[model samples]
Target: MVDRPIIFSAAMVRALLAGRKTQTRRLATSPLRRVEVGDRLYVRESMHLWSAGHDAEVTFAADDRSFQTGPNTGDIPDASLTAYFRMVDQSRAKGRRISRPSIHMPRWASRLTLIVEGVKVEPLQSITSRDAISEGIERAGGEWRCYDSSGTGCLGARESFCTLWSSLHEAPGQRWQDNPNVVALSFRVEHGNIDTLYPNLRSARA
Candidate 1:
């Protein structure tokens, strides 16, 4: 029951939060090459975006020299106790680098955890309409002919997903055709903090 950290772009995170995305496809050769039932994935959003909650207040500094973090009513921790930057910085600063960056993200940084329910491997172009909806596409109430822009009606589920994927990975050797096989992992969002998966609580429930 190890906790594996998986970094997701902000768009994908939003889809997950909205329950529109339940499956993700990965290159067969990537670190996430294989998955099994019961594996848990800790989903981390982009490190750059910081959003405010209903009770949380955000303030910007007039001068670029200083900044305010939050509006917590509780006592604040001493600034001297913490070093602000990420751990990876130290290695990069010394001219060294970590090869597999995704696996190195700290567990505490992940806000959501999902339990894998199924796994499969197939060609990249095998997405079905049902699966496309699972991948977060809304039915445009007709097929969009990519060649013409005459407001050709709705795009099919597969074509819609292709558009989304192409937007994210547009580089020449990284397009859809370049990826022959993909490992698809289907998961369900867990109800609480990811911490529950690392301990005796899961065993107790079992």
Candidate 2:
């Protein structure tokens, strides 16, 4: 199985962590089109880091929970820890917290991995109610709603998914109305660092 990095917004990260999300749809870009079942995706989410000497701690922006990273405390390797310390030092020198974009997160810092179970290509607007639910829509009081929404009007699953799509893809040709082709990926979440869970993959890469 191939291992790759995938970036997710903080909201989506929370959904994945909560077991509410099982599917994600991305524009049919070349990279996404290459993904296949059995491939592993290590999630990259917004995070902050703090360090004391060689020991460091990571605070995920999604839940704002800190976890120690080191040989004794976690699976993070020494090389990765050293790289994180450099980032921490640079941030402190600039008088700011060590926060970086999700895309910049290293694989060692990732706490969530997704194992692709299925893949398909379809129009963005073709998402069904069941698929929308799998995308992390919430059902409350007999109403399906987006997780970030208040569910005030109590929309259906498909409608809630539309709202979410609009929020994330507002650019021209990327909106829900655009009906752009998308790569739909269905996956199961694994709650651990990719390298830790798949040590053989790490060795192969090295």
Candidate 3:
């Protein structure tokens, strides 16, 4: 599995989003839809802010997944791709369907698990769990306690890996709603699978 970075200028990101077929009108609290690089269109979340300064958000329809044409380095006007070693679900919107993106990958490449570390999260299975999210908490050296909800098809199933990130010693209250940082997790899946799952974090330079 090769690892690389996919960097997007603020402007190019908007052009990509503008090309998407789904109307970018709604700002519902949902995970940003996955957009394929070089294939699908994309728009940055920051571009949608009005006077109230809504949260930065972007969305791509599942249809764009098949259009992924790989990463870009020369400022391609079309949607560009970034090869990465990890992918994180930054759109922590609760109650949305968590389906796989439509990228052009083999069947074996579809199976992946994200190991988020260095934060606190609560398992979405707690009574306070939300319908849209399989929540988890990140705490103490990448350790996470996740809540597996019925939507995840892992509710009460110990084999499930659904979890949410939370703060240390904050108890199991609904405090995650106040977190401002984008949701990020550590990577430990198959080498090739890492970037596909979290291109943003994997491409980010330290």
TM-score per prediction, in order, is 0.62, 0.87, 0.17
Runs in model 2 lying further than 4 Å from the true structure: 71-74, 78-82, 88-96, 146-151, 203-206
* Colliding residue pairs in candidate 1: 142-153, 142-154
Q: State residue 156's C-alpha deviation in candidate 1, in Å.
A: 1.0
Candidate 3 TM-score, C-alpha based: 0.17
Which stretches of candidate 1 lie above 4 Å from their native place? 47-105, 139-154, 171-173, 201-206
What 10-residue stretch in candidate 2 is worst by lDDT? 197-206
If the candidates were sorted by their lDDT against the true structure, best first, what order would they fall in?
2, 1, 3
Candidate achieving the largest TM-score = 2
Candidate 3 lDDT at 117 equals 25
Q: Write the per-residue lDDT of candidate 1 for residues 39-141, one digit (tens) a residue.
A: 7777754332122331221111111121223334221122311321233344345544322233343443344688888888887788787887787655444
Prediction 2 TM-score vs. true: 0.87
**By TM-score, highest first, what's the ranking?**
2, 1, 3
RMSD, candidate 1, Å = 9.0
